[model samples]
Target chain A: MNKFREGGWHILLLLICLVLLLPVVFMISNSFKTLQDSYHSMLQIIPLHPTFSNYTTLGRQIDLLRLIWNTFFMAAIVTLGKLITGLFAAYAFKYFSFKGKKWIYLIFVSTIFVPFTVIMIPNYLVISKINLLNTAPGVALPQMCDATGIMLFLKAMDKIPKSLIESLKIDGISSHMILKDIIIPILRPSIISIGAIFFINSWNEYVWPTLILKDKSSFTLPLALQNYISSEGGTNFPLAMALSTIMIIVPLFIYLIFQRYILNSISNSGLK
Target chain B: MNSSGSKNKFLTIAYLSPTAVILLVFMVIPILYTLYLSFFDWNLISPTKNFVGLENYTSIFTDSVNRKVLLNTIVYILLLLILNFIIPYFISLIVKFFINKMKNSYKIIFFIPSLFSLVVGAMLFSWIMNPISGPVAFLMRHFGVALPNWTNSSAMAIVMLCLITNWKVFGYNFVLLLTGLGSIPQNIIDATKIDSIPRWKMVRDIVLPLNKSIAFYVLILTIVQGLQYVFTPISVITQGGPYYGSSNIFYHTYLNAFVLYKTGNASALAVITFLVFLILLYLEMKFVEGRMGNCE
Candidate 1:
């Protein structure tokens, strides 16, 4: 009975894995086909004459290096900015007994529940009036501070023992030193977790970027890819798949490299 | 003026200033300003701003399209909750039970789609589901079946959009659920074994009850995020579709403001969306917070 149950579980697992992998496998296989092969009915599963021509075409179609760099720089800056601010706010909420802290934390948490649709118009107006429209900073600025990240960091910081803070106070170390030397060092895992999430969130953001950046030269990888995907006739499925294959793979590579930290962050999102 | 003490407060605020100020000015203020804007008729090109009290809100209540958008928003949220919640909850458990050594790897693979830009993910799926050359169509033909265009129908398009969104976020959900699963203490399972409880009873009486709080957290978070307006798929894949099948309240607001430049109508829609979000959030907090307390 035990062996049979185990075998049944393994088979089910294999089936689930296959379903999870199907689209990704199809994407890679389809990416190598010629545009003509993609349309042919008989040549569906496997490309009869696979070629690197679509990738070669993609290289020329978009400024791959510049777009990638723009996206990376934007995501990195926001991640770093969010980390600094989130840590400070977390420290304040966790340790400082400031008046109205409860209301402030409530507001902070409430901000996570608010939708961007409600604020997009006003935010766009504000961005335009500040003379930052169509600029990289405009695209990146509004998204820099995420309420969820601050809340996560705060909750994690709360878990640190009061004894630790008492020890720092006994040593006459200022809150600044406590945060920098003691708190931050202890919060390294949470920092990495938060950093991975912020990086990925900013990287994947599209709606705001589409609204803010109108110049083609300023388009990020995702925006540029969208334009490329739509500009062609629907028949260019192979090229679309090829570009998407690259887009999916780069992030997939990043997540794989830091899978542990990213998983830790996803878990953090739940506890708060 | 006390220099040293003031300096410490300044230092703390300074460290916290960049993030807090950005969120306040950009996120909080904009939302409030949007609420205010909904009360008036203001077009961007015109310098004239006319204040009309409660006109926009009243119009939202009466307008047919706005009414439909509201219904669509609710439906979208419900569909997405099922996709991101119920499906992933089971998937996470299945993955955990079967795949031990490569759990982390599976988590990473699942999260890959979500980490990519929304537009990119949407566009990829759009191609894969295209009626003529999409893989879905190809498979149908292989089995000698003709597949209808998935994104061409209003109802089916919304369903497909929900499915794609689910596929995109499932890995993240699975990871979260896995963490919750891992948090379940081993001694509890041992206790169940000692009691000679059946497998189903062990799950019902122990695992589910213990992890109910995290489950609620996941459910609330998924619904909130879903209602925020998934723009990528709407814009890239459906453009609100063959006849507005995929359009939700948020995307409808986006179209009004950006595409049509009807600032007044768009702000009205925005107001409605905000109210809906607040209502759902209040309910979730009220119920879930109380339930979480009981779990202890």
Candidate 2:
């Protein structure tokens, strides 16, 4: 009876897993099919006459490499910018005693409560006025005011004992030297985890990029994918899937390599 | 000593300024600017700004279509709360019950979809639900059944949007709930076992009460992020239509600003959405506090 029950539960779990994995599986398989094959063999998991024609067509239609490069560059710069700002802000909150410290910290953390929609228009106006629209810096700069990153680093910094910092201070070390020599090394794991998160978020961001970027050459991968879906590849299932598959491939690899850190940061922050 | 005291003050300001300036210019200023713009009548392209205090707010309240957009926004949030929070909470419970040594692997697999960009997931579903050459149609044909045009039908499109949102988000919530469950004290479970308390009763009395904070956190987040979550799917899949069937306030706001050049109206809507979120957040905090107080 015990073995039977366990076996049944396993089967149930497997079925649930299959349902979850179905779309991902379908996307990869269909991306390999010819357009005609995709239409005919819709339900089939594997294409009978699989071909790479869809991918080749996608390459001809858009500058795939340039789009990917734009996405990577933006994500990298935003991640680095967020880390620097987050660290300094967190250091101040963690190490210093000052007037209105709690209030200042609260103000920073409370930005999370203000949804992006509430600030979208004015942010657009600001970016446009500064003539940063349709530029990579335009897409990245507004995003660097990251409350989540600051909060995460603050929490991580709190875990490091004050005695250590005090000891370094007594040894004639300046605050900057303490940050460089003591804090950075101890917080390396958290730095990497938070950096991965910021990178993935900026990479996958659609709404801001859609609004800010206008030039075809400046389009992020998500915008490129949206453009394909809406205009270029209308009702062309194989081509759309091919473009989506390519979009997923880069982040998919990053997620695979940094799965542990990514999941850690997500579960820790509990903010999506 | 005086120099050192002054130096400390200067250093503190220096450390905090970079983040503070960015937040002020980008976040604080824009939020205030949005509120300020709500009272003005200015096209985004116009050089002159005309102050039209309360007119934009009045129009959204009076307009019939905008009213429906408001209603749809509320409905979308409530539906998302149920689908995203309630269903996932129970699913996490079930997974926790049956999970064994392979729990970590199950978690990673579930989160795979969430790792993909929202637009990518939305486009993939656009293909999967494609009426003429999609999998749903293909499967229905095999069963000698018919599937409605999922994204085109008025009644089904919003529900379909809800389901897709749930699919992308379910894993993230599941992981959160799983962590919540893991935090339950082992000794309490062992103690409950000693009493031979019925399993369901024990879970109700012990597990649920202990997990209240995380459950509440999940609920609050579902409400807060719910509006933004549906935007991508609506835009990509339905364009908020087969004649405004799935349009919510967020999509409506986007339409006003970008498509129609109604900057003042969009600003008003944005402010209204923010106000609604604040009210909801206050209510949730009160409810959670009341529940915890009762438990104590």
Write candidate 2's Cα lDDT for A1-272 as tens digits.
64676577668667767877788888889889887777877667879998999989989999889988999998998999999988987888887778888778766766766677788898888899899998889999888867777777876776688888877777768999988988999999889888987888798888889789999999999888786675112567778788888878776888788898778777766521
Model 1: how far residue B26 lies from native, Å: 0.7
lDDT of 1 by residue, A18-102 (tens): 6656776666777898777766732356778988999999899888788778788887878887788778777776766555667
Q: What TM-score quantifies how close candidate 2 is to the native fold?
A: 0.94
- Lowest lDDT sum, 10 consecutive residues, model 1 chain B, at B287-296
Candidate 1 Cα deviation (angstroms), residue B225: 1.1
What CA RMSD would you report for each candidate?
A: 3.2, 3.2
- Candidate 2 regions exceeding 4 Å error are A1-9, A231-234, B281-296
Q: Encode model 2's per-residue lDDT on B134-221: one tens digit a residue.
A: 6787888889987777666656888888777887887888888887787788899789879988656877888888888778878877
Cα lDDT of candidate 1 equals 0.74
True contacts kept of each: 0.58, 0.55
DockQ of 1: 0.52
Q: List, for all models, the DockQ compared with the true complex.
A: 0.52, 0.51
